[model samples]
Target: MLEESIRPDNLALVIVLQACGILAGKEVPVNEKGEKTMALEIGRALHYDLRTFMLEFDNFVCTALLNLYGKCGAMIEAENVFMSFVSLDVVSWSAMLSAYVDQNCGEKALLLYRQMLQEGLQVDAVTSVVVLQACSALAESERTLVIARNTRKTAALEIGRAVHADAYKKQFAYDLAVGNTIINMYGNCGVLSEAEHVFGVLNIRNIVTWNAMIAAYAEQGEDEQALMLFKEMHKHCITADEVTLIFALKASCSMGCLDVCHCLYFDIICAGRETSSLSASLIHAYGRCASLKDATSFLNELSEFHLGSWNACITSYAGEGDCTSSLFLLEEMKLMGIKPDGLTFISVISACSHTGIVVEGAECFMSMSCAFRIVPEGKHYGSIVDLFARAGDFSRVNSLLKSMPMPSDESVWLCLLGACHTHYNVELAKYAFDHALMVQPKHAAAYVALSNVYAYAGIQDAICGPKGTN
Candidate 1:
């Protein structure tokens, strides 16, 4: 009705609404009174035609459309709309580049950034930050690393410093977000001292700054310093959330700090974020400390048990050499309709090996493929072979070897060979050794096992070839 009347103000309002429709990823819902006001207001801005629909829209409207497309991974649509513009400015370029980088097309982002530079477009802070991220992403490939390292060496931190330096030639060292990026860049580059120096001088510190430092320390296995900094974080009233706690728990687990992990577990529970993975970590910590009862009780108390939680408890029991409990848990998992994954099966097989439950282990191995359709990996096969070999079922072990659809791994062959040597089966030991050697040509362990077999049988001289009869 408004378009037929040729009302310029009403038509502008419709154009605005249409742009918003594409921006918000929805069609505009109808409203009357508000439409009239918007129509009158947008009339003061640009006019639009069919091809100029996106481009002639207000900057805010156009940018929002680009953002929506970028965020949703409609890169082609985004590019089409971006290139449709008769005039391309910095914000327009940044929007498109951010989309490319965010969607993991970092190399393309870099190419566009170079094009932007060749056009003498003035890059602003947000644009520089996006390019910095692309630099970090590009660091994984050596060829890409050279490009990123050179770009970062020029643009990221030094630009921040230079921009500040140009103010009466006085360099201001601290811009919170920029400083944090520099800290991150330095930390990622393994220049920890420089990162620490930058971090110490920063006037404002956010969780990102702290997280960067903590991750840097954690990656280096500096658990003590990471924990100390974590304490400092709490003192500074920076509440450590899930990401913080997960990394701390990993450090605690690595350092065998069961008491610390236990305390964190209660803290997590009190915070009302009892995620299964967190609970699993607690079980792992307790299990590592040989506290099987505590691990079992913790698992039982949880309202829902996931695969990780179950695997943690099973592995704990197996590690403690209590295969019966591990087997019991495996059965319970099945009864609960939780089919065993590869890790779960391996944990149970380990338990059986420790406790000499040969028959049960064999049944579990068969069930892995037949019932679950989970093909046994080399590690799983090795564990089962070890179980049977340890139980002195040489015939069963030989049959398993012959029946394996996949080639036997070196570890599997080694397990069988070790068992043969232990049971004084010389012929079987020789066969196992040969197979192991076939799998791993430079297997010094196999050579040692074979020499011992000959020595034990008082045929060492023949094997060593009475070659000078040394």
Candidate 2:
């Protein structure tokens, strides 16, 4: 029609722009940016033509342009097109939210979602999907950031629950994509029961659905349940994807089930799905389930040992309370010119704690920042604090707890409470018990531990009061 000089309508332009977005998206995956010169230039030329012809521009056309610009990695252009409209529509807002998520700007996506809701724009399933994706991304990214850089905590899970409530009210929860995203959000938040609710209600299930559910179980430390689902999927004749295998291997690693891991490894090899990451997990599983010799043999069988493999082997040694082996492997890893990451240090400190080697643990903790320039995570702090607490070194424990950069979690406080119970420090026990309740208000274990501390101190009157407040 263009060759014949036939005038194309706005609908025709939207179709072409949508096709361009698809092509550009193909060039760059959702989380990455790459040059899509051909698709980008063609989309720009179309934009020029739309303005030159003074053609009809409506929400459909604007949304199409927004999607094209978003896919081409031109978010500013997409925002301009979106803001050009006086009354924002659901599709336009959804497009921009998607752009933000695709551009790895989850916080921006969430902010825009709130603005859209404030404008009283009712959302559809598409909007719900993108919003949930943003929530999941924010939750995952913040968790990663907290672990990597020791930054602030995330409230994306609360926002996600609100969005989920709205989707349920709007009857958009029935959509498959929306349902899948809901499970993913719950999974990211470590809320397995909610994920299970969404999984049970989904009318149609796919491989992504099963994988999401399995991952949720794995993350929640319900390894047996995760493996059960892995076997259930096989019973349903659903082929396991690489992610499915990976999570299954992780479950096996945690369970220390060598036989199960061998089966999974056989499956991976038979399917020709062996990769470096899978091999790393295999090494980890071998170290956990079998002898260290077996794990070392597997490492030697590989063409090369990546940093992950070393970390896995070292961590497995630490987890098994093989402090000498873990320390030796750390030295070996350094000799190979491989630097240890934060995970490696956590294991090293944990191994030290297991062996009651406070001096070595403190040195490793200090080395995280001074020697390797790596910031300590909450777990690192928790491990070091536990090491000191077990040694009855209350002063160091107090100093570390007070100097913690980030807010303390329940586990860290609980570690202190457990120590106070053993050493019978009434003041420290009260402090830890209060903080534990502050972090996890319903932690019965904290109450029990505090009661033990009180019982040891003969504080019967305090126990008679409301939760030892007296």
Candidate 3:
């Protein structure tokens, strides 16, 4: 249309912006040089053209522009667009909050939500859902930060409960979307009782409601409760989806309930769900239950497994300290012409490390590139380093450290530090500790490891000497 020297009216412009918003984050191709024709890029171009034409932005165009910038992850631009508004509307506010959630800025979103309430904008379902999502994300992220702070994940859950109370007072609590998000937030925060309370009061239940509650129980290691909830959902005639089954299986792994595992497995199969994608989960469940016979039986039932499924079973066996079985499965995969990836070797080598099969593990590390032409990544090197470190083979460890092409990072040095503590090598422990601090000055684990090393060495100072010196 522009090539014909024509112009879009305000309605056409609104429609065009809305269409662009739909494809905001997707990487649409605009040229061969691989630049993303993202919604933000397109919207900026259109905005530039409008400015060139000296056209005033109507309310619709302005709002659409904010949505476009937010959805395309241009938060600064989105905030500028939002701040340009003279007054707040719920739609624009919700878009801003949703964009914050998308950017994982949970704290920002919640602050904006509180401000929205102060502005006396009538809360709607969209705003409530967006707020709940912010609560959920804040709950999870705060929990991670709490690991460093050694505090309860109170910030997110407290804010989440506040949101629930506020939204409930506004009569938006019973809305399915808001209710489900409340359940999810509580669940993610590990507040099962609160999550259960929300679940009980929900006027309508869907697969998501049950899944969230079950996942809550499962994630907190409440196996029996999780399984009971799984059974109770069927009583409601709610069919289990893939996510529900995965959570159920996660619970089953710890409880060693083979019967429950089989029941869930058959339910998935009977529902005509594709078993291929779930093969690894099934194998893991059986392996955790310590029922190799059952695991083998399940493997037989599958038509064929891709490389990932085989690796899953191998990893399972390795984790269970069944290194022989892991090695056998590896050979079986080779016979079937399935190439093992770096992950496969990590598990296999770690198993060997635990079992003290040093020579075989060393051979496997050297053979990685020669046999499969797969270059080892840092993780692969870490596994090998761990194998040698745990073996108390300091000569080989020192040799490997010297020969490693990649620069030593905190993990590698910490691996050596751990072994030094275990083997009572004060000198090397001091070296490793210094290297660790040099790599990451504030790593909590590094300090803890240094403390451990000092105690093990019968050295009371717990102070560092110097880098690369005793």
Most accurate candidate by TM-score: 3
lDDT of 2 by residue, 1-470 (tens): 78999888888989889899888977744443544667778888988888876652677787888888888877777778888875677877899999898877778999999999898888888988898888877777743424442221136788888889988998888678888999988888778889999999989999999998999898879999999999999999998988998899889989989888889878877887667788778878887785677677666666665888888888878878888888888888788788899999988998998789889889889988998899888888888988999899999998898799898777887888888888988888888888777776657888888888889878884533225544
Please tell me which model should have the higher lDDT, number 1 or number 3. Answer: 3
Model 2 lDDT at residue 306:
82
RMSD of 1: 11.1
lDDT of each: 0.71, 0.83, 0.79
Candidate 3: worst-modelled 10 consecutive residues by lDDT: 143-152
- The residue-by-residue lDDT of candidate 3 on 153-173, one tens digit each, is 567777778878878898888
Q: Give candidate 1 misplaced runs (Cα > 4 Å).
A: 1-203, 407-410, 413-470
- Show how many residue pairs clash in every candidate, following the order shown: 0, 0, 0
At residue 246, candidate 1 shows an lDDT of 72
Model 1 per-residue lDDT tens digits across residues 156-229 = 44433333333213333365665666666555555577678878988899888888777667656877777778
Name every residue pair that clashes in candidate 3. none
Question: How do these models rank on TM-score, best leading?
Answer: 3, 2, 1
Winner on TM-score between 1 and 2 is 2
Model 2 root mean square deviation, Cα atoms: 8.3
TM-score of 1: 0.61
Lowest summed lDDT over 10 consecutive residues: which window, candidate 2? 145-154
